[model samples]
Target: MTGFHFTVLIQLLYRVGKAPTVILQPNRTVVYRGERVTLRCEIWGGGGTEWTYEWKTNNGNAEKSSNEYIINRVSDTNSGKYSCMARGDHQLTEWSDAVTLTVRLSKPTVILEPSGPVVYRGEKVTLRCEIWGGGGTEWTYEWKTNNGNAEKSSNEYRINRVSDTNSGEYSCMARGDHQLTEWSDAVTLTVRLSKPTVILEPSGPVVYSGEKVTLRCEIWEGGRRTQWTYEWKRNNGNAEKRSREYRIITVNEYHSGKYSCMARGDHQLTEWSDAVTLTVRLPITPTVIKQPSWAQIYRGERVTLRCEIQDDGGTQWTYEWRPNNINSPTSSEFMITADSRGYYSCRGRRDSFTITKWGVITLTVFNSHPAASLSVSPDRVQHLIDQSVTMNCGGNDTKWRMRRFTGSTSPSYVQCSNWGTMHGSSCTINRLEDHSGVYWCESGSGEFSNAVNITVQDDYYDVIILVSPVHPVTEGDPVTLSCRDKEQNLLSNVIFYHNNKLINNDSRGELKISAVSKSDEGFYKCQHSGKESPRSWMSVRGEKD
Candidate 1:
């Protein structure tokens, strides 16, 4: 049996063509839940033959043998890849390329018609309910609110006028034939009070002339997203100002008025704010300040004038002085050296701009004879250290005494017995020192002479240069160099040097360097009449970039 068991074998073969293709009836793979869909399988380019179709799904569901598949209600659980094949009598063709099907749940949403979530009171608003993936099915709508129990059946909810009680969260839901959609995401709705208030900038409504004033309109309860246009009325005037604030610069009496403001936003107008009144008055009058004395005074008597604002108290103030109806170069106070006589007036100022009314005062001058004149023996105002100097009071008076006014001390006449010898209306100092100052003559009748200033220089009276700002001068700053003796007496026809090299010769004994730089910094000195001064170091600091 094993040897002779060679049986005849016949091989069955089938000609194969292009693979089949699957087509969806609706041409769309995605469908909403509870929607009906049909998928049809087709075979192309195969020989004419009777065949049976088989279907497979990537979701591991059982296979079927139909050319078309119908789903009464598609759901998320039935979504997957689908394929089909055709089996003939002699052979089976390859499966078609996969087609994906996706199912999504329907969800409803609520949207505001005007887009802004915040609405002013007395404004009309609308809320719309919408459902996606419902497949043109008729749906019933319902709304829920967090603030109060509100029910509505239509797809849209209309609010004729919003109020504070309507401010809360809002949500919607839709119901179809087969299912009820989940509640949509909540949307917030705000209803705000649109009452506005008016305020004064300086708090106090009363202000002086030349002061600035501002009126501001404010809405306290409205949301920041609300845009507003302001309307302001002043003192019930017919004209209305369209601005948030009204400013008055250099305020005067005409600018004082009662102001009221109102706002309009979100298609609604707010109530007028409380009215506020402002008043502007003239500045306080200025007063003259000085020692009380007779309005009329004789010549050679010192005169001083000072001005003050009545309300200034101790506050600092600047003064503008007018002498004889002409502007004078004086501030806060004025000094008249016995030679001046005129009518003086002054105005007190705050911040150099706000000025008060001017205060006036008068002065008179009278000339007298037998006046004394002071003179120094050396003829020069400055004397060398330890050098004897003689002072004589030249006048017609027979009896006279010398008087001195030092540093900041008050003047008083006294005898020369303390520090010098008195000889025939003259005083002689054996050795001059720093104590020497302004000197004059006083007769027995208390008549005073013209004053003369004497400055005693130190032993090191050589030429020296003085710098306005000592060392470490900043770049771009002005610098001044002065040539003088040890007693600060300026010298003329002096030559200045930088780093031992001659720079320039100045007849005024002063050198000015505007906007100093690094090159201007070095050892500096001055030479006058073949005399050289001690060298001084100067440094310029550069600014940081």
Candidate 2:
């Protein structure tokens, strides 16, 4: 009995004693193809003993000196029930329970966060490699790109501060336990560095006050419109508006500044646009300039007036005149009638309905016809008979003729040619008895000029004559009258008379009135050396503002 028990104990020592347990990494039954798997054989109650492992698969069986059976790269043939056994020096363990392993041909899908194809510079981009049907499996990723890059071993690939050089087609493959999956579809990445452009309406570096202004932020990319949020800035300050267009209803001087804009969309922010300058200016003041350059206007006369504005170069302006009753034209030059006498004002209007200050002017008009002026060469009203005298008709007409009314002539009206030598608008005649009458000028339309009385003296006696102006003098003008003898010599101790009344008895032989007004208009005469001169009229015109 002792020998038989020894034999049984010796056989049990070399035969199976405890069953081995198959331990699988990841503890999963389903796995992807090309995945790495390891089966470890564990023996209970077998301590401190070296053992060889025997692995059984659906395809075949293999023996390894190590207690663990490892598949470097699992394939479809590796998908089957796996069992492991351990062999010791003096004892052996039975085969552990079968562990099923499924090596599937499932491909992984690469997902891109913030999935837009284009990304701006200085942006953070993340690419993820996902394995399908790979639960409970730790995966490592291998990334590929058109642009050369260092290999990475992570499920997620992150690009920080990405730039234009980092743009290319990117693909990734997942590796779990030393097995690699198929590369996913390429997730194209386009890094853009293009900036936006700012545009201003009316394109003015200088704009008038109270004018409308508009600013636009534009982005050009393949001529397609993109939905983006805009940011506008003035003078490089904070954002003013978020819309693509910024408008100002009535721009003033306070609105003048440099402007810029930028855009952000699809998790990307573009660079700020080049700054555009804007300037606002005050409205110009217009000035009214008269063409005739006269303070007084006469009837039957046409005057041209111009509206002038400073700093209006390269600008189109329309004129507006106040006192619109005159029916003024819209041009800068206005033709004014004599009847349109009053205060005139003008303003300039721009194309955008901006206006300038009003410019004012005053016009004075005379209704009645003014007598033509007559000038004599001798500057005196008295002359001796048979003495040569010249007279000229001064006026705005060319049809003026020198005429005289002599009481002794056959007809009362006669031209200077009938009794003297006639020139163009002038006549030279030898003084005779018939010439000692009222001399004047007459136009072809029967309008008469001021008449002057001439006394024909028989000899060079103690005779006196008055020298006065023949034409009407404007108000605020100077007038002078002097007395002369028959020989054309000035005399002293003169007594001046106005309207047959003694006004002055001065010894200067002349009367000087500074700033003559309408009150100074009357018939004036002077007496010198006990000789009284003929009365002459001094006409004065008034100025109105």
Candidate 3:
């Protein structure tokens, strides 16, 4: 081969083994503020071989000679076009394609004071717009809420006495001269309402024993009814109930106290309501006192009936007295000249409406007969076992003896000895027995006093008749009759008798009268399987005349 042929072969071999092309590392052109950005020089076709690199900007400025061009902190000053070249052992490659580096302006942000995004009613809050880079006082702030433009212009927005209508998403932007920045990150603001009020049912705070009471708590907020949880506190203690309404089956004196409530929903708790008070009172029972505690008083003598209260405090009392077939008198103590015979009852009053139970007494005024007359205390014809009975022979005479008669035997009078004790003109019988009979007084001169019939019964074995609302029931009122056995257990399938005549045969052994009249007043008894209960008298008083 000649020299020309050899040179052509060498040129063809050098063209096949040429240097690789240089290129930029990253394809992106945008960079943010305060970010670390790196531009690298890369060779595309040089099969795993290393090369030296050099970088330059479009402004003709020389950068570093390393394989990578780095900007520790990029800003607006770093914006330009960049290119790189790679150097191999044989020759240097051409410049890479130019890459535009864009450094954008920083975005502004919105911040809320007092930490939380929620504020209660009647409270103040502040929202501040912040931009990192310094742009002097010429920067104007604009705000938007819930995607709608707001009419404020200050950097700091102050809200006074915020309400529920002020809740929305808020954002801000900065404008200086002819340049306006993009909107900042959005923040949410929530305005809440205060707590609700609690109310009592029946519209009154006073409660009596054996009565039911109810308390209700109401909340008006934006949520489903089932989402709310109610908490109730009695006298400032821990929660006792977790329902909207609190109920009391029965109220007593110990149940008197204050009450409050609150509501919790949506991971938030509302303030407590204003406290309310409850007052519970006990049943009132008054005492009746009869002056000159004697079995009988002569005509033209002075007698007094007094009404009193027991174990009571912090109360002022008035009184009322009712005598049979006569107008009632209002006084604590009533005085009368013993010229009439009647049944009398008295009651005490705390206020014009609040009254105690009535207590009954019987008074008998006797005329002066030439012979002595015998009378009994309590004036009741029937007496219970284990009860005391007293008999008095009217007169100051000392030589008086007591006698008891059984059946209709002639002259069959037995002198009192083992049956009772005698104390000058009076005889006392304790622990009455079934054999006790009619009694009369006998003077030393063989003259006899008036006779009185006395009947004795066993209190434990006798049936009890229960009257709803107790005895002395007012006329034109509903009444219920219940028969109980000696053990206080209710008797079923019993027959009720009024005035010794069968009136009703009920399975539940109860008799009810829808409205009572004067004719309903009578003696009542109950009978079960050939056993009869002692008669109990029911008294119904008419309305005031």
- lDDT for each candidate structure: 0.70, 0.74, 0.68
Instruction: Give the best candidate by lDDT.
Output: 2
Which pairs clash in model 1? none
User: Over 4 Å off in model 1, which ranges?
Assistant: 1-318, 324-327, 333-340, 351-353, 368-370, 376-392, 396-446, 451-484, 487-545
Compute each candidate's TM-score over C-alphas: 0.35, 0.35, 0.34
> Candidate 2's residue-wise lDDT over 1-545, tens digit each?
56554344334456676688888875888777667787787888778877777877774665554777788877777788878787777676777888888877567677877688887666788988777656667776788887456377687889877776778888877777766677778888898856777888766566778788888998755333557889898998888657999898999999999999988877767789999999888977788987445444554344567899997388778888877743466889775444545888899877554678899988876675556767887665556565788889889888899887655764456788888888889989876655776677778977665555565655556767788764556779887788877667777888899877888544566788889886676678887667777676565655641
Off by over 4 Å in 2: 1-194, 221-223, 322-328, 370-545
| Candidate 3: tens digits of C-alpha lDDT, residues 1-545 | 56554334332212213333333334567765666788877665765655777787855865558777888777778888888776655646677777788876568778898569887666677889987653453788899988886655798988866767778988998888666778888899988766667787645576557566788887655433436788888898888657888888777788789989988877878789888798887756666776544466545344567777773365666777776333244767775545557777887765433556777788876665426767787454455566788988886566889888654333456677757888878888887765446577777877666555565556655544332221244678887776555454677787887767788544557788889876776667666766766675555555541
Candidate 1, run of 10 with poorest lDDT: 291-300
In model 3, the clashing pairs are none
Reference-based lDDT, residue 515, model 3: 92
Ranking by lDDT: 2, 1, 3
Off by over 4 Å in 3: 1-28, 44-50, 59-62, 115-123, 135-137, 194-545
lDDT of 3 at 163: 67
- Relative to the true structure, candidate 2 reaches a TM of 0.35
